[model samples]
Target: MERDLSRQELTAETLVLWEKTRMSLRNCIKRVMRSHGVEDHKVWGTVHAYAFEIVKLLGTIDALIDHVTKGSSTREMHPWVRNPLRVATYEMKWRDLKPAIATSEAVRIISERVGDGPARFANAVLYDVEEVTLEEVLEKAEDEIERLSIEYSHPTWYVKHLLDLLGRDELIELMKANNEEPVRYLRVNAHLKDPDAVILALEREGVVVEEDPHVPLILRVVEWNVPPVRTEPYRRGWVTYQDKASAAAAYALAPEPGERVLDACSAPGNKAAYVYAYTCGEVELTCVDINPRRIEEMKRNFKRWGVEAEVVRADAARLKGVLNGGFDAALVDPPCSSSGSYNRTPEAKWTVKWRHVRRYAEGQLRILRGVADLKPGRMVYSTCSVTVPENEDVVHRFLSHEDTYSTRKPDVPVGSPGFDRWMDRRYRHHRHMIRLWPHRHMTEGFCVTLLEGG
Candidate 1:
């Protein structure tokens, strides 16, 4: 029999993996672009995941770069500026950690690889890092980008974009909110128990929790790491890991028990599972994705939740052969550039060149148009992207071309309205859409648009 690793052992391994993954992520982006003929979604997406986990441990990569370039130990600095030590300094200075402890961990973790002299240099320079007021830092920075980046602990492009969209004061609050550890939110499986009861159950288990006004069954974890999905209640198909905003997308669809629903692009099937949970297994759900591996994940999630859904590995755009106006509703959560997810997936900021956003928007429109023709009744179109081009623009273009389709606002309780006309005139009716932002909603930026048609 294999021995189960203890928590301390797991944590130690996770830390080491985190450091190595960070290095790989930074290197992979450049290497893939240079050696491989392709630099597409899959490569960038995997890199983004690695980058996200790295930032969660060590904070922003930008700050690490700045420190390496300016630190006193220039001779000892890693030539690439994407080393574990640089990330270590950012964590010590910006993230909540004593400088000595963070730097010591960095040295311990990277000493052999970085060499004795470089390790010593890293330790020395990190000790010099001191906490300063945002005001003090901003006062010292002459450039607006540098000032905002340091003050908010985000990339310059991200800060500039936020400033343009939300203005300076709001950007500060947004950035501050993003830098903090993200809260884990859950969608209670109402099939097993009511949300209120679930909250009580969690509290009884010594979990500190809070309910947000914006979403139903969305519980924010103040403390505790009890894997709810692994618990008996969850095994009995009672709870699932779902964001407040994501729950809203399924809720907006309001899939009634016994309704036939199609979940297009349902890879890793959280939303499809939520639909089953929400309706308590009464709905006949068909979940489809292009990747067979993702179809397998959907099956695993379904098995975990004790829910049944027809999982298909097929292109959502080419679903014409499967059913002919046979579904009551459908969910189209298409692939996107994920700009609004920068706070949670910081690696995306690095991979996202200016052209990527436009390209994603164009692809999103194509998918929306393809799916609009197949909606038997009302369908919900969604993405994890908060950008106007991908969210509202695609919806707008779909609506313009298919005049038979009209916007149907999901009756979600809370979320800021979509961007203003000044930002994007095409999304005028986007107020009905839900825009979840890390700065505002404390979740990844997600937009869901409800469409009504044949």
Candidate 2:
């Protein structure tokens, strides 16, 4: 009977720890992935499972530490104590739970798991931890690494990398943004409604949407929990749920009716649907992705939009064996570090590390090399990553190394220019790459580079 009561409280505390600890494990997994080149879909299931174990273990340890530290008042200890103490403090401060309840839950979870001594230690420290403010605790932190870790609840290295990319102010905004639930964006499926008409339709339906100047047909939904997609307009394929930035790729491709299009790495067929719709179903589209599971999902989406395309599960880098060189256009939305889309999938930021970004860049280069072989005069090579190494830099390296490929600007509404020096160095004759960001354009990060064949 007593065990059941204790278990219930531990469970409540575990829920709080679960969210915090899962975030930690996600950061760790991303760090290790680049060394090994693992994808998120493969690791996310493990992350979900490991989150429970991590919280349970951390809660147990905090309890144990408190047991050892008893008799000491909260004022005596340094604000930054053990990991579990820090975690418990997060629960009390940020989570809005009763401090005593938070402390007891940590103690219960620890004592039940680790026997008496460790549990006593965790209990004692947690009792002393209730008074410490997150800001005060961070001030007591010895270094930037420790400070950012406690302050943002992120791994130290990840915070440093963000600081390197975005500097101090922007990085803080990015981190705070990631911690919140993301806004959902939609791409007006052009097959159903032209961009202007779609906006009017959404407004008429009481769905507030703002145009993304950087992206062609992307719309940002101001109010969440409103399932605008379920509305008659959306049900009739007027708009598709996609990041505004992501929609830029297919729109840049700008397929014309009766054109032959190849979409490499196109599973979960948002782009394929966009291709068929944007071209008004005039183009013959061939879509492919390596994962069969994603292919099935793409098929479902394709069906939903009432667009027909030849879908295959195959590697884009090895498509020479299967697809001929007759394709007039191709879209390579290959695997990437979802740096730009992190706003939509906050869980993604947790999974990104410096190494994974490099691996994605290398893999994208190989995919681009394969794309060059198709002899496409116009192709879109895009990623949902805002990282220079993955977007402009990847295109630069590809053009520098691949003798047959060049660059061009498409006919669509122009967005941001490509990186200044990189373009001058690689394609001085033409600069047609487009960069999109959430902060500027109110969408996820996306880049679309137009390539002209040799």
Candidate 3:
């Protein structure tokens, strides 16, 4: 095993890995720390906070780097140089670290990883960045879109999209919420443990939680001295961390005892597990996804939550001959740009593009069609995306093509109605869809729609 590295070095390494692989911050941190043989939760928490915040403010930090480098963008720099400078700049600007201390640490890491020349170059950039304020960078933006883009650390296109969807005031509020620490929720695994006992155990373990009024099984985490995963309740599988909006989807689907259900594109299987627990493991479930790694993860999660299902590794969009259809109900939670989850996974704000949204919309329609072909009585189409194309537009297109299927209002009562109009068209059934906003709902940006047909 490799020797353990300091938190700063670990954060730099994790940032570089995230940039190179475009993996989520959590996965990158786990890989980096595991490689270094480090298992300290305190150190992991420090590295996670630093790395996530740095990535969350990447657009601003990169702009500062460009300003200091006299127009040479961070894209031109080596990962070792770029990521370390990001860490250093984030510390100096956001964390209020002294420039000298942040620069010294960054340069030391760069020197050890690369060489003295690049380290000296990084040192020069940090020295220049210290004098440049974020306001100066924002003032340089040519227009409002670019200004908001840099200020909120979001892509230019995304800023424009949100501005159009939400007016100026609401957009700013959503952007601010996206930058804050994501809210955490724990769902009591009622099948495996008593809900009252689980809540008592969590409180005993110092995890403060309050029950969600709309959804009884869901608990909003108020505060915690220990990480939820480290708590004995979580260890005993009495509670699982899930977003409130996500838990709402399983309830929206509302699979009953002995109903045949399909979880299309399910991976890491939170929804499926919730369904199992909701029905007390009496539902006949089949979960499908194309990724092998996620399939393995879903299996492990099922084992932990005591969920049983027919797990298949296959493309959900092309599930015709691989498995039998005729599911009584299905949850078609397709892969999406994850726009709604930017608050929890800030890296997505930088990586997701407009074209990717269109692509996801296409794939989402295909999965819905494939699952519809299975002749389920009802299906819940959901995504952790607030984008219209992936939510309403896909549903509209699917309903248009598959005349047998029609939208119904989901039983979920907490979220707002979906957008009825997109571009030049009007979706008649959009009123039946549900949308959760981070700013308004205190949940991940999510969309859920129930359809009954065939």
Candidate 4:
């Protein structure tokens, strides 16, 4: 044998470059689900083998496209036959591949970009999805929360409002921790570096990270071989990619040094550059945002976190005459229905529902009643959102129409308190709110509170 036909012509030219890189990830998830309706697995983050095969097909590739279109309505197909039959039913049910090589590579990418009558209707619906298997292709959902929304592809009215706010054993351990894959916190730019020299330069670039006996100088990559944004202690800033509950809401909105804060929806400014890098640039912040391109991406994230502040664009929920009343503290962080970061933005749990969380808790209670005219002797009101009509019913209707505001409790050190029977109220300073909890503090679902003013 001539070297077994030259190793079968190099395995058919490596399956023609893995079927043209899996049809360019099904046309980049059908052009980000047809221009941002969802499906942006953050552009498969630098292709870690297609980011571990598209985040382990989170929410199970829309439950393997409603079990290969059996229950129809992928808005009646045709994003070139619904994103190449959702990438050939996620490579024949979660990468087991070989359903005749995922229906002949989605009919050779719909006969090279749609032709031959949509490649014979994507080869007659992937030849009836390669004769179903992944648990005999179920999902004819009709109840039991649309069969746990096609068994956890989510969005059956968000599993019937998380089965009435988490009751089926913590909504089945928060829907199996929102379908796994997530755990990569880090924040030690300890006011410009030195948490033991940024953990010995992120373990000489292999990135191990760990320290976090409750948030300060955060860190928790726990294990990595690379991709702490291709480390170098995240390029000399010593570290940043935040989310230890958004750096414990900038150390529980401490923001001191010559005060005068007010972040109020500051875009791209992660907690206003972690409150001017934990007040070293000495707060007098400002930042606001009604988008002048997110105030130029919060002035390029306060010049890449060196952090100085004062960007402003206006309309922090109608800051009467684009602000004037002075401040000593305020954070706000409006916009909600993130549903506690849907386990790392899982296409924001099918683009957030419940009328977008009652229009994002009525625009976060009109930016908490227009930032209480900055009579802000401190205010926080965060929200990655774990819902309670967008966190404690928009912080109990902004402390029942600001009786000069109230609630306090946030000495940080981890969270979970608010939600003292929400939905027919019963809050008594909902233990001064904090709430975190992606299945208890692997954290992502967030909600802070802390107010004062009077």
Candidate 5:
């Protein structure tokens, strides 16, 4: 009983931190665990699962709380009271925990942490939440967008945005896919180990995987008795986890051996490492990123994969005097709204807004213009986003200003063409851009466009 109470308290505290800091949920969990000196993997796993599940359904959960409280918003409540109530409501509704037990645990935690008044309030809220069903709250939605948002736990604005782009049936499919468990893929490091040998090693460790059809050396994880990271093959760096669509971006770049390749806005450099592995360490790689911590992480990753590259710490948007112009190929993978990655990073669904998407498109255009000045023979701009503004519009805006470069159809075979509608007229080279959908591709939504210098 005490163990269960501790878990609830820990999860509530983690949620409070996430709300306060607005950092990634995983990072917030790490901070809470470290502060409590909690190192048990079992506890970590339990807390992680609970926190992520609650956060993934935040919109729905908050709506339920608001409905029960009768016009009171969860945002107005104290974190101590609010988060504990959220944790309890999730347990009751989603985890199928006995309402009495879930409410009792939440009230106990709130009473111990805040005081009796808040605890009493939380108990009343949970009691009310217990009587209501999610379907009841969803039925109150004023429109289809709001209903879909509540049902799938996405922001209402984002649902409407997707509906505008994909229409009704496709938008619902995407929302359903976003709420499901994300698929994991492994890319065998063919530079260090033979693909067959890596597969044999993974199977020996009780990991079931199958080859991805379109992308060479990529495998879909079927089942695993042991975590892949703890397995021998992963320990030896023979295989690393990467989405098949992400790996496709590197293939689109297709840097040849002995050519100078620039990876802009690249840190935690998975794609750059893939390029090195693709060329068997023969490509001259230079990676640029602004974050020091991610740069260190990328360095560690490079060492593990036997990859060699020059790391530069600077903004990709303003690279003059920091880098030279001569390069055979370059990859411009700037950060964006990350809408396509909501399944894996559900926190982003709440954090990113339409305004942020417009800002991202602006920033993406700047990075493209900056990188284009360097005159790489070929460049691929990619983002883990499904929005038109960040993909096709950014490319269109860049090409409008920069006449020296032209769009080329990405060599990769998978994914659909970019949307052609721009201001009621067709974008000139919309077919040159490729979009991978989570519903269709079983991968994170991604957009890739290839550009060539004359």
Candidate 6:
């Protein structure tokens, strides 16, 4: 008979594998580019199962560190010993695991990888770590930022940033939404089949689906007997997994039949695919990405969705020399901090810093300026971000500089309006922009700003 390895043992081993194999979640844009197929299949499978557990740990890791070390700096401990203690603390506080078991397991791993001295320190810390609970910490939170950070499993700055834009209740609501698991939204391929037929087919496959009332082609998977990817509709290219917010972007862009559309920054191609889906494959699209690998990836994505696009390798930030700009409508899904998407990609939640928002905002603005092209009519400036620096702030600064363009409200509007004053910047047509809250929409948080040539 084989012994069932304890959670602590599994967690310790997982941490070792993670330290070696995990991808950088510093921001959203780069994470999508890297091919993250782990060679060690066993480690891969085990680590994925504990992803939520890891996320739960991240929210409270610092607090646990503080408590364990008698409010001393965690920087003093070696990372090898410190990490296992984080996992052990998470298991003990959140997972209902015993303190002795969690502490013992952590000590065992630290002793093996680090040294006896550090392991002894780990042992003492974890004993104190076991005393700290998420509720207990929340009960004694110093301020709103501290409370929301611990409660939602997000960084303190992230919670602090939103407070100015939202009230205490609203901020808490948004954070709560970010911490929960997201629904898998799939876009029905209207070009291939009818909406009812696709829903029926998915239902027959033991996949419970609910179509979005606002967007005809988008469906929300309520339950799944088999994974949506394994379903026949997905395999046949009759439906593809996409966010409702992305599908909303396609509708907002509203490319006409025989219109020329440029999907700038279209790698991983969800928005690009939706352009074709919404246009019923009638529009001519030029899918652009700077990276050669991303260009290849976009090609594959277009093929998978039966999406026809003129895939091109071009730097979005500077496109003057590469190609002449005479695009009718450009779907500029430019890079942002991916603030809205951190909930789904929890790794990014930990890695994201306040500084990233401004950097991403600059990059997004530069790409927007390039994609503005000579013959622009309406360009959709969209991001999977709710932050001001990435969303409204970028649009605010761009509209000020670009004299030819003005704020144009996206059609198919059913969302909260963008803020007039966020921190310091006050947008002119703030109400014209749309901000989709995940808590309200049950979709990935998105900000879609449209610019039209005068």
What's the alpha carbon RMSD for model 6?
A: 4.0
**lDDT (10s digit) by residue, model 4, range 1-454:** 2221111122222223333354333343344334434333443332223323433343455555557566675556555555556666666766677777766766666666567787776677777766755454344555577656555566777677767867777876776786676687877656787688888888888888888898777788888777787777677666778788877876787877888888888787877777776666776888788879768866865666577767777788788677786888888888777767665656566546788788888988988888886577878888887778777777787788778878889899788787677557777877888888788788788888888874
Give the local distance difference test score of model 3: 0.88
Residues 203-284 of candidate 3 have per-residue lDDT tens digits of: 9989989999877689999998888898988987888989999999889987889899999988999988888888888999
lDDT (Cα, tens digit) per residue for candidate 6, span 329-406:
888888777788866766667556888878888899899888885456888888888888888888888888888998
Pairs clashing within candidate 3: none
**Which pairs of residues collide in candidate 5?**
none
Candidate 4 scores a C-alpha RMSD against the true structure in Å of 18.1
Candidate-wise lDDT, in order: 0.66, 0.66, 0.88, 0.69, 0.89, 0.76
Local lDDT at 30 for model 1: 50
Model 4 quality (TM-score): 0.35
Q: How far is candidate 1 from the true structure (C-alpha RMSD, Å)?
A: 7.5
Model with the higher lDDT, candidate 4 or 6: 6
Q: In model 3, which runs have C-alpha deviations exceeding 4 angstroms?
A: 1-4
Better of 1 and 3 by lDDT: 3
TM-score on alpha carbons, each prediction: 0.78, 0.72, 0.97, 0.35, 0.97, 0.88
Worst 10 residues of 2 by lDDT: 1-10
Pairs of residues at least 3 apart in sequence or in different chains that clash in candidate 1 = 376-454
| Higher-TM-score candidate of 4 and 5 | 5
Tens digit of per-residue lDDT, candidate 1, span 94-136: 4566777766766664565557776676566555444433354
